[model samples]
Target: MALTTEASRYRPSAIWQLRLSLFMATYVLGASALYPEVFYTSALIYSHKFLVGIPVLFIGGVCCAALIHGRRQPVRYALDLAQGRWRGCLLVLLFFFASLTAFSTYKIAIPSVVPYYADNWLADVDEWLHGMPPWEIVHKLDSNNWSSVVFNSYEVIWFYQWFGTILFVSLWSDEIARIRYLCAAALTLSVLGTVLALALASVGPVYYHHFVGVDRFHGLNAALDRLDHSYMVREPAAYLLKAYQSGRPSLGGGISAMPSMHVAFAVLNAYLLSSINRWLGVLGWTFAALILYGSVFTGWHYAVDGYASIVVVSVIWWTTGRLVRE
Candidate 1:
């Protein structure tokens, strides 16, 4: 057989393919299991999106491919990558997809298989979140917007997951499965934390479980759902809806409380920001603030969960920093 090229020689194509294969392999295997570990976990409630997500994903794959035709020049770069030239870029994408999927799968795989806490917190939270009351103008600040500037926060905080694998790849391109493992680990924790918060904790702020007449301000909750509608049967860039639309706040609701991953990812971004850019560190703080605000303001998470999530993400960041050796 003729050699593809030296680039292909060092290229971790095999690992890439393996990562991609194993990524879905484990997910599908677990998803297809008669009864996944999650089923017996007694955490999630009703789960239905799994089957719905497949065909939507297939169509999305076709869409993304079609979209890529416009950016085909990058194909040469990818070819060079196949030859192992731009492993960082390749790994970047792999990390993003793998981590996102793994984390998502881990959190809800159990619920879909055999929703456990469907009646406990999942239903309660859903009933509570049925409709957000009009924003209260307690203080006449910014027209009682109750929202703040949050400069740079939105970008810095979100950048973590969006670009986490990319940065990891840039540093650990030489390390096989480094990004993959990191992604897996992050995802595992994400799912774990999300599940615990939603199902195990089964107790959010004073509202979800019981109405205290206190506005939760979970606007993001609804916004998230709106965006999810676009992807529910499409590409689902981040699989944002996996947890939502699952019936009763969907699968996402099943694991929506304590140790909020929103806070967790923000913490991760802040940690990474400190290393990549100092100004970004400042933004990381801003991002954390936004997340904290969103949690309480939106009533999606408890203040305690925000604190716990911070701790979790901090540890994950510290540990991952070492793992990637960056």
Candidate 2:
């Protein structure tokens, strides 16, 4: 169970040091290109560093060492973890798998649009505050094409899922056995959220399409389905769509969309990050707010859908955290 202990004691071998350096290099280069203003024409030569050069180089280093050293490295590490282990790894993994499997196995025979009562309440509250003309004007000003505003919020979701999950869970978790639970929590709930998306389908209203005047991307469910089918996209978001395709068109696979899994996964990451670092928890809240906004703004979900997702994520955070503790 001494996972963190091992990492702290780890004086990285030359190969591991190289791998670590490359990983950091790739992250910096890739993230720097996110802002258009920072994109320098003079640095165009190094711009390509993110696309292939840095990431590929980093990936190559890790793969080479892990593959070449293989079992020679992780044995002492594994033996350390095996000590005082409670065998909770399998149970946690199975719990996660079973939750997903059961959800996938039996499709709920209800819902295409479970609108957010909470969002409705928020709108009302905001309006009430707006009775003061100046404040109302400000609220209105802040409420521009929120769909597009939220649409761009996808970056935070990915950051929490991939980066936070990897860094916090992988680093802070001292118990090798517990790592399995983290994985199970991450992979299973994430997959289950997607499965639930098919069953509930809370895409807000088609008025969204008419408002945006884009007839092509229709229903929230339809858009998700299309993305699922085209999982070959190089973009990481495409992989999420693919995860939704895991369960078939059975009772388990109703193609509805009540609670958004995108929200659920973000919630999971938030919990994990909070457990690892308080600062991360605060960042997660900001991230969650944007994700909630993104759903409705992008027309990918209704306000109700976004609200429902928030509720579901809250539930998921509580349930899974308990699983880890117990």
Candidate 3:
């Protein structure tokens, strides 16, 4: 959609933008105090990624948008940017990057601060809730062909959706809805991704054996290994394990299992997209469901982690909507 002058006029004040930045700043400071070494190292790593990756992604997004909107819209898009009508969205993005850096840093530090003591408990809870390991239920879908789809959806597609949703809402015409989305997103990452993550620190099913000294999920791992298309899934988990062993902050290095952030963000995206249109809403929710299943199927999380994330994100979405409207 083209950016309109009426939408620009209704853009929320810089205060909302400042709130997001301030929250990130505060989180960074607190986390730095707790683990200065990790905070500084993670900052360096993630800063470089954001610097190189964001421009490439933003340009790609612009190109795609131009193609979708047709040749005539590029001039208007450039003019909108030139006139500073999109400044709020840009500011929101800047703060978002900052928050993400802090979140990643804290995620890496979770094991150092809290240790992985909750995996067995969470696994048992999963068994109790589902009458068997959640992976058992999801693994029923496992096969060479389906594994490829799940692997890409869980890793590659989720990355696009995460950034794509931000760009989508950034360009949305409704200022209030945009602010509400930004608020909810910030809270979800900070509260669910970091704070509660630390409080409920666990290694998840995939890493349960390594962290807890038990091969409880060996069957699950073996099943994944047998799937020809699941190398994408296995490789990253190995990389994270190496990073965890070295005690060095690498890109996407942290490992906290309880309350899967993947599922959390997917749920958040569903809520935000649904507010825009029903069809997009259906697409968002479907993707959310897929990620939820993939989280368990891939052994990245217990079933309850996704369940809790869905509930918590819904509450955050609703609460932020009320707060922004007031």
Candidate 4:
């Protein structure tokens, strides 16, 4: 994570670097036009979280840097922040929050717009590809002893990796790399998380029985029920269902599962981190593999969802890299 001399001296053009912000502005406007109530409600909900979460995340990031890199590194980091690095970081955070607001709003609107008709198709595709439902394969490998750990990795660690990568790249001195990462991330969410998800509106395996009125995943659900820490997965799934039913925009609410955003973001993190260094790349990919597995293991997604996400996100990442380099 050492800043290269070229990066330290390089200053990106304001318009070019603010591409994410501009994209988000256009997206927010478009979303508002289509779903004003959902857009505004999501904006309000996420805005509050933005105001409260930013400072806490900033402090936590600094503390972690201090603990990992020692006292002098924190001083240098603070100096960088004061020396105007914060502007870029602030823009990144704004883009991220805006993306979340837009993504969640679209996620909430998916069912109303398209309806959940892809779960059965996705399930069939998963079985066709894997010779059986992926969840069954995942369950076969699952151990009750490690269910909690896997759940936490999928739920809690995913958040940390998601936000932590944003924070890390936001502060990265490499302007081209930073812009590339940010743009790729925004595109991944907008395209894979929103557009394709809406096009292939599916409630995923966990909620398949509930939404589609079929017990297609009964064995998968039963296996989950047998897990020692099934509640970790069940509770959030229940909350999402409740929020969806209530037609309310809650924090981290909404569900569309064709292309797993968790897996997409994980893969995106892997690409960006690998560019920084080998070890980080390894760590990123490992976490991504875990997330891919957990997405099915928790019955939150079909195996094909994760598979499609990896392919689409890779293309998006590669395309964004070329754009930034240009």
What TM-score quantifies how close candidate 2 is to the native fold?
0.42
Q: What lDDT score belongs to each candidate, Candidate 1 first?
A: 0.45, 0.41, 0.82, 0.84
TM-score of each predicted structure versus truth: 0.49, 0.42, 0.91, 0.92
Count backbone clashes in candidate 3.
Answer: 0
Which residue window of length 10 is worst by lDDT in model 2?
132-141
- Tell me the tens digit of each residue's lDDT in model 2 across 256-284: 33455555566666665576679988887
lDDT of 4 by residue, 1-326 (tens): 45785554454534456666778788877888888898888889889988998877766665565566655577776655545556766777887887788888888889888878888878888889989888877777778877887899998999988888888776666777877887888788889988899899998888888888988888988898888889999899999999988988888889888899999999999998898889989999999999999999998998999999999999998898776776
Clashes of each: 9, 22, 0, 0
Instruction: Sort by lDDT, best first.
Output: 4, 3, 1, 2
Worst 10 residues of 1 by lDDT: 135-144
Model 3 global lDDT (CA atoms, 0 to 1): 0.82
Highest lDDT among the candidates is held by which one?
A: 4
Cα displacement (angstroms), candidate 4, residue 29, comes to: 1.2
